[model samples]
Target: MGVFGALNAAVSGLSAQAFALENISGNIANAATVGYKRLDTSFSDLVGGGKGAQPGQIAGTVSANSRATNGLQGDLQQSQVDTYMGINGGGYFVVQGKAGEVDGRTIFSGNDLYTRRGDFEVDKEGRLVNGAGYYLMGQPIDPVTKNVSGSVPQIITIDNSVIPAVTTDRIRYEGNLPTTPQTSNQLGGGDELLDATLTKASTGAAPDAAAAGQTVGVDAINAADEVAFLNTSIAGEAITVYNSSGTPVNVQMRWAKTFEDNGTQPDTWSLYYLSDSAATGANPKWTKVSDAQFDSSAGNGGQMLVPANDAMTITGLAVDGEVVGDMTLDFGTGALTQFSDSNGSAKISKLTQNGYPSGDLAGISISEAGRLVASYSNGRTRELHEISLVSFSGEAWLERVDGGAFEVTPESGEPIAGAQGRIVGKRLESSNTDIADEFSKLIVTQQAYSANTRIVSSGDQMLQEAINMIR
Candidate 1:
C-alpha cells in the first residue's frame, strides 16, 4: 500500500467516529426538548485499497461499507409533539384550520384533523377554538335558526339572544277577611261612635241612639253594659273562615277581577297575589281541594264552602275577587251556596299577578355529549347549545398547518364526528417529552465514538508497520 494512501484510510475511520460523537452530543443537549428524537450516526468504510488489484496492482481499492440509521424511526418519534390527552386508552380531539391562505376562503367545510393534544379553548367568535386558534368543528348550523338538525362536524357557539321567559305571570289565592260589621268603625259617620260612652242593654244596644236600647234593622250594636256600675263594650258582627280540619290556613287571594250587572256579568280584575306569605321554595307544594272550597253560610259571618246542584261547576268564593258568582261549595255529600249572608261586602285579600321579572345569565356547564347549559339568574337553567367534536382514524396523517390547526390527509380517512365528549374547564395537557430516555441514548453514542477512535489508532499502527517494511 502507498504510504500517504494508507493514512487516508485512517482519516476516514476517525472522521466517522467524530461524526458519531457530534450526533450524540446533540442528543444530550436536546434531551429536555419536548418531542425530540435522538439520532444515531452511520459510517462508511473504503474496502478496496488493501494491495494492488493485479499482481503489482493494488489487491484492494477503496470499496465502501456503509452503516447507519436512516432516521426514519426518529422521524416517527419527532411526530409526537408531546401534548397528550388525559386518557392513553383511546381517542383524541381534532381541531380545524383557522383563516389561512387556502382556508382564507373558508371553503373547506370546517373539516376535522386529529391530534393527541387536548389543550383547547374557545375564541371570541364563539367557535370552540383552542388556545392554538384551531376550531373544534361543530354540527352544521341552519344558517338561519342555527339549530343543528343534521350531523355537524364542528362545535360553534350560537349566541342565544336572550328572549325573556315567563317568570310569574299568574297566581291563585284565598283567605278570610276578619270583618266585624258590628265594630265601631264606619265607612263615613256611624252610630257605633256615639254608643262608646253609653250604658246600654244586654241584647240590643243601638250605637247611634243608645236610649233606644235594642239593636234594630241590619246595623250591629256597639253594646255598652254597665251593670251595678260595671262598664264593658261588646263588639258587633265579625267574620272568619277555616279549613275542613278547622285549622285556620290563612288564605291570601289576589283579586282576579271585578264585575258589574249589565245582564252580562262584568268580569274584570282589581288585584292579584303572587304567592302565599308562608310558602317559600323553588316550587312550593299547595294543598289541593275541590270539594270543600271556602265560602260563607247565609246566617254566619265567616268564610265557608257549600256544594252545588251540578257536580262540575262549584261557586268559587274567591276572597279577593270582586265578583262573587252564584257559587257553591261541596264537602263531597252535599252542596251549599257560598257566602250568601250579611251585606254584599265580602272581604278580599289582595291578589298578586306574578311578582318575578325576567331571568339573567348565570353560569355555564358542559356535558359529555357536548350540551351547553346556561343557568339563569332567577335560579332557572336552560339547555343552550349542543357542541360537537370530531375525530380521525389516522392522526399521524394530520398535517399541522398553522394556529395549532391541522389539515386532513387522504391517509387520515374520513372524519368521525360526535358530540358525546364534554370539556373540562380550567385544565390543560402537557408536552410528552421524555428527558431521561434522551440522555441515556446520548451516553450510548458517546461510548460508540470512543470505540471508533481506538479502531482508527489500531489501523494506523498496521499501516505504519507495512510502510516500514517497504523502507
Candidate 2:
C-alpha cells in the first residue's frame, strides 16, 4: 500500500504539471491576441481520509485549478481605424451575441457578454461586430434632444442614409465693429452719389450734407435706405449661409455709425443684410435688420458692450422666389464690441450658423466620452449613440466565453451599468500574455513533469523489490 501510494502521488504530480503546461501553452498561443487575459494554474493537496495517517507519510495527492488574470490590464495600441476603442482604467464593453432575426430585425441572444476587445468593424448590414462575432451595444442618443433616449442598451447599428437638408434657424456673430468708417464721398467722384441715399452738397467734392446736418434715427432707416448707405461703407462683412434646400445664399452685412443722442448715449450702428437679388444686382445693396448699440462702460467695466437685448429675428428672406423661414441672429454680450483700432475695419472673430444642407454619410468616429458621432459630407456632425461599460465585483470569476469575452457568473456578481473607465478612440487593447513569462513557466513545468516521472520509476523499482522478496 505504501509503494502504491507513492506511485499514486507521482501520478498526481505528473497530472498537476501537465495542467500547468496546458495553461502555459494557451497563454503562449494567445500572446498576440487582442484583449486576451492570461490564465494562472494553482495547485492544492488532496489529503488522505485515514485517521491513522502520520505526519511524514505521503498520503496526499496534488490537484490543479486554473484562475484567470482578468483583472490585469493590457497595453493600449494605437490604430488608424476611427471606430476602434480602448478602455484606459477598468471595466469592459457591454456586448451581445447575434442570434438570427425576429420580425425582420436583427435579434441578439438573451445572454449579455462583456469584453475588453474593441476591434470592431462595420459589417455589410451596417452593424458593428468584433472578430469574436459579438455585436456592440450602446444607448441611442436623440439628435434633437441631445440626450440618451433609453435606459436599456441595444445593439448599435450604423445608419448610412443621407441626412435631409435643414434650413438656417440661428446665426451667432462675434466681432468688433469699427468705430470710424471711411466716408463714401471720399471714394470715386460725385457721380456715385446719385445712387446713394445721402444728400450731397452743392459742390460735388463736398461730403454728405444731410449726415452733417442732423443725426439719423433708427426708425427713419429702411431696408432700401440702409442698402444704399452700405454700398460705399468701409465696415462690412459677408458670409455664406445655407437655405432650406441646402443652397448657398450669400448674406452681406454692413455696419454704419449713427449720431449719438445728446452725445451722452452709447455709440449706435445700424445692421443690414443684402437681399438675395441685390447680392448680384446692378448695384450691391442691403436691408436694415436692427441697430447695434455699444456702451463701453456696461458689463464688468470691460472694453466690450452688452446690448440691452442682443437677439434679432430676420424674416421675409427670399432666395430665387423661395421664402426661407425666419432666422434668429444672436450677438452675445461682449461678443460685439466697439474698440479703437488703426484699421477701422470690422473684424469677425467668430461667425457660426446652425443649419446644414442634405448630406451623405462621410465617416464615423468615436469620441473620448464614448459618443459615436457621424460626419456628413456637408461638413456637419451628429451624435448617434453613447457606448456603455459594465463592471463586476469579482471580475476574475466571470465565465470565459469564446471570442475572448466573458459572461456573468454567480461569483462575478451583478453587472454594474455605467461608465467605468476612460474610453479612448482609434486605439485597441493588446493581450496581457507575456511570451517570455510563458516560456519560463513552460520550462519549469517540463522539469517538474520529468522529476515526477523519475519518482514514478523509483516507486516501480521499490514495488519490484518488494515483489521479489515475496517470491
Candidate 3:
C-alpha cells in the first residue's frame, strides 16, 4: 500500500508539473499580444485523510490552480491612427459583442464585457469596432444641447453625413480703432491734404464753414462731404460675411468722429455701412448703424460704452439676392480702448464668426476627455460622443475571454460607470507579459517536469522491488 501510495503521489506530481508547463507555454505564446494578461499556476498540496498523518506515510498529491495577473498595467505604445486609444491607469473600456443583424441593423448581445484593447477602426457602416469584433460603447452628445445624452452607454456610431450650411449669426470683433487715420483725397486733386482735426458743436447741426470750431451731425454728411473729409474725419473697414445660402457678401463699414470733447465731455463716433446701390444712388452713400461713445473715466482710462440692453444689431441685410438675418456685434468690456498711438489704423486683433458653409466629414479623432470629435471639410469640429470607461473592484478575478477581453464573474464586482482612468489618444496598450520572465519560468517548469518523471521512475523501481520479494 505504501509503494502504491508513492506511485500515486509521483503521478500527481507529474500532472501538476504538466499543468504548470501549460500555463508557461501559453504566457510565452501571447507575449506579443496587445493588452494580454499573463497567467500563473498556483500549486497546493493535498494531504491524505488520517488520524495522525506521518511524514512518509501521508499521500502527497499536488493540485495546480491558474491565476491571472489582470491587474498589471501594460506599456503604452504610440500609434499613428488618431482613433487608437489607451488607458494609462487602472480601468477598462466597456465593449459589447454583436449578436446578429436585425432589420438591416447590427444588434448587440447586451452582454457587457471589459477590455484594455483599444485598436478600434470604423467599419463599413461607420461603427467603431475593435480587432476582436467588439463594438465600442459610449454616450452620444447632443449637438444642440452640447451635453452628453443618456446614462446608459450604447454602441458608438460615427456620423458621416454631410453637414448643411449655417447662416452667420454673430460676429466678434476686437481690435484697436485708430484715433488718427491716414486718408487719400477721393476728389479730383490727386495729392491734396485736408484738415484731419475733428470739431464739435453743442447741437446736432451742420458745422459753420467760417466758424473756427464747429460741430457737424453725422447724418448731414453726404457723398460729396465724405469725399471732402475722407482724409480728415472718417476711416473704413470691410469684412466678408456669409448669408443663409453660404454666399459671402462684402460688408463695408465707415467710422466718423462726429463729436470730440476737448477735455470735458465724452468723445463719440458714428458707425455706418455702405448700401448695395450706394455707388449709383444716395447722396450720403451710407446708412447709420449706431453710435460708439467713449467715456474717459469708464474703464481702465477709457473704453467704448456697449449698450446696456445688448450688442448693436445690423438688420435688413441682403447680399446677391440672399436675405440674411440680423447679426449682433459685441465689444466686450474693456475690449475696445482709446489710446494715443501714431498709427490711426484700426487693427483687428481677433475676429471670429459662428457660421460655416456646407461640408463633408473629413476625419475623426479622440479627445483627451475621451470624446469623439469629428472634423468637417468646412473647417469645423463637432463633438459626437463621449467614451465611457468602467472599473471593477476585483479586476484580477475577471474571466478571460477571447481577444484579450474579460467577462464579468461572481468575484468581479459590477462595473462602476464613468471615466476611471486618464485617456490617451493615438496610442495602444501593449501586452503585460514579460518575455524574459516567461523564459525563466519556462526553464523552471521544464526542470520540474523532468524531476517529476524521475520520481515516477524511482517509485516504479520501489514497486518492482516489492513485487520481486512477493515472487
Q: Between the candidate structures 2 and 3, which one is better when assessed by lDDT?
A: 2
Pairs in clash, predicted candidate 3? 201-215
lDDT of 1 at 263: 27
Q: Write the per-residue lDDT of candidate 1 for residues 174-217, one digit (tens) a residue.
A: 33322222222333344321233322232244323312232211
Off by over 4 Å in 1: 1-89, 100-111, 140-148, 158-160, 167-357, 360-363, 396-407, 418-426, 445-471
Model 2, position 99: C-alpha lDDT score: 88
Q: What is the C-alpha local distance difference test score of candidate 3?
A: 0.74
Tens digits of per-residue lDDT, candidate 2, 1-471, equal: 777787898999999999999999999889989999999999999886566648654567899999889889999999999889999888999899988887777778977899999998888777788889998889999989999998898889889999998888788988876555444643444322113354322112343233343444232233334445654454567766778788877676766665442345556566766564534423323445765666644353223342466677787665435566688888886677777656757788888888778999898899868898999999989899999888899999999989999988999998898746888999999999988888889999999999999989999899889889988
Top-scoring candidate (lDDT): 2
Q: Poorest 10 consecutive residues of model 3 by lDDT?
A: 194-203
For each candidate in turn, the TM-score is: 0.41, 0.84, 0.84
- Of 1 and 2, the candidate ahead on TM-score is 2
Clashing pairs in 2: none
